[model samples]
Target chain A: MIIQKPGIAGTLESSDAQVTVEPGDGKIEFELESAVINQYGLQIRKITYDTLKRLGIDNVKIKIVDKGALDCTLKARIEGAVYRSCNQYNDLPWGGAIQ
Target chain B: MKNPNMKRLRRTMMFLNAQKPGLIKDPYIYKPDSIMLDLEDAVAENQKDAARFSLYHALKEIDYHGVERVIRINGLDTPYWQEDIRCAVAGGCDAIRIPKTESALDIHLVEEKVLAAEKEFGRPEGSTLLMAAIESARGVMKALDICDASERLFGIALSGGDYTKDLQTHITGTGIELMGARQNLIIAARAAGKQCFDKVYTNLNDTEGFRKDVETIHLMGFDGKSIINPRQIRIVHEIFTPSQKDIAFSEKVVKEIDSKKAQGIGVFTVDGKMIDIAFYDGAKRTIELAKASGVYKGEL
Candidate 1:
């Protein structure tokens, strides 16, 4: 639930987003850079916030470099980076926290 | 929708890295019989968890048209396989491939976990099917047990890369070193009434060599092949598809066999070839393959 350390996941592939997360100062700090920022930027931001909320993290600095990744892919990248940041590898809550 | 049939037509099972959204998002466009969403070997060690996240999400959201979605989980020897099973089962994968399977006990172990995960995820108790990859000498020697390990197991596949290493050899392209394992695996799979699949031919440049390898496996009675690329899918399907002549002959043989059996005759000849009850299944299989390949016009 806590972003104890910095964690990063994903790549700058054609249909992927590289997500980076670090501990933030008592509030969610989100930044996004995507190819389709004119159209899907708000949707991408909402997905990141919702995914972070699901994982019980509201106080983290999350940066996303999106290359036109879909909603599912964005969520996966966020979950991956969040989990890695917390060093919680075993007993992953697949459909629970990660969903 | 996820394919429900356990023994459907699977001429090609294309491997895709679960970590790459670009790769897994729309692989069904290539029209492989199945897509092997790999969480093992294809993913780097540090990226295992990341890959699982990608895999779970893809399985949940992606529309694979009619292509079977099979997840290749991490091996049993690692701590990753359990979560891999849980993720794949929760994501509603059509099947889970156990890497480096060596014994019946290994299959049983995975089956137990799969059942538990299925219950936890509220999936049908027996909906999650399984397949094992024989990647070692021990696995090949114990192929029958692996096939008979669980009713959930629909088939077995040869992992040539690792199996060859265990055999103290490398890929010779001629498949001479793999002849024994391939023969043994298909025999075991047939004996257990399960499908058998050949390994991926890694050489992308040698199209001719790939064709020959596919032909050999097709002649050896393999139900399908593990393909690495979309280009290879056509080759496998083409080789596996029964020719029009073969389909026609098979239909005639089936009809003739039925008439002969009705007349209380067990032996006869069709088109100058000796026919008997033993040849009936092979003939029927050809017709079925033709139907699956969309080449059959005869009704028998």
Candidate 2:
């Protein structure tokens, strides 16, 4: 799905990641800010990219302010932000595209 | 299509915000009989959509270790309840709880949407059970209708916060304000053969008051109570579980009842008490509660 506008999901609370998705160029632009950056940075990046790919979002500026969120939480925040950006809330593909 | 879990033990149904990753990630550790993933009042107005995403993933990926997952959907008045149903059904939640249910029609509307979502998502036609939260005077008066609304409805719960507001009173912490509603709801649910749950006791600091409230509800014949904190779970379980002497007496009652029935006796005294068929189910229930609470190791 296309990122029609900027969308954000999640919180600065501990064990949550604030995900932001915005329209981008022809390629994916990724940025991350997390306290556990040195330890689990690569895994977090992989989860973000993998989730974006699954949602058919190839070109978007995705940023996550991670507070030690798990893989499932990161995916949820990404899905929430991506869906919100497209102004789509109903009839969401829960296990389909969002998985 | 009958729900086997209709009569399961639910001494405590803990509420957890669906939007909070930290809260929802691992609540099964506390081991409440069921976890209510609140997509309703617990979530902010603008965050409802985001909460659903969090809920769907949690339902799909989190292994709750057999703790029942009941999602509290947005009320019927909201535009969000439909999508909330779809997301919860598709994510394979065990049940959907409709908040502020006033009549049978409300349950029918929710059941219709749940059926459609189940079919659309390829779940079994009646796989998803439902619960109704009676939050107003209208809902309390119509409790019997709501209880008998659908075959998928396993129970009804009291949401005391809004209920008190509708009654033109506030929670007095003395349980005086909620007497009528609680009595009426339990009677309606029992009359309809559905389980009834009491409202949450919010004063966490007043453990003594909480225990008294729980004990009162338990004695008043409520099957369970809604809990806000894990600290409340142990207390509810402690009060709800049958004592060792009670369990032993129940076991003897069951055995005596069986033996007496085979010998063509209708009523008999057990331990100098006037025991009859009327006491049989109650005795059996005590034994069952013991077993469920992990305090019994008896064969019968």
**C-alpha lDDT of all candidate models, in order:** 0.93, 0.94
> On residues A1-99, what C-alpha lDDT tens digit does candidate 1 reach at each position?
999999999999899999999999999999999879999999999999899889999899999999989999999999999989989888888778778
Calculate candidate 1's fnat: 0.93
Model 2 bad stretches (over 4 Å) = none
> How good is model 2 by TM-score?
0.98
What lDDT tens digits, residue by residue, belong to model 1 across residues B1-300? 333576789999999999999899999999999999999999999999999999999999989998999999999889899999999999999999999999999999999999999999999888999999999999999999999988889999999999999999999999999999999999999999999999999989999999999999999999999999999988899999998888878888899999999999999999999999998998988988888878887766
* Model 1: lDDT to the true structure: 0.93
Candidate 1, chain A: TM-score?
A: 0.97
Q: What residue pairs are clashing in model 1?
A: none
Residue A10 of model 1 has an lDDT of 95
Model 2 TM-score (B-chain only) = 0.98
Q: Quick one: how many clashes does candidate 2 have?
A: 0
| True interface contacts reproduced, per candidate | 0.93, 0.83
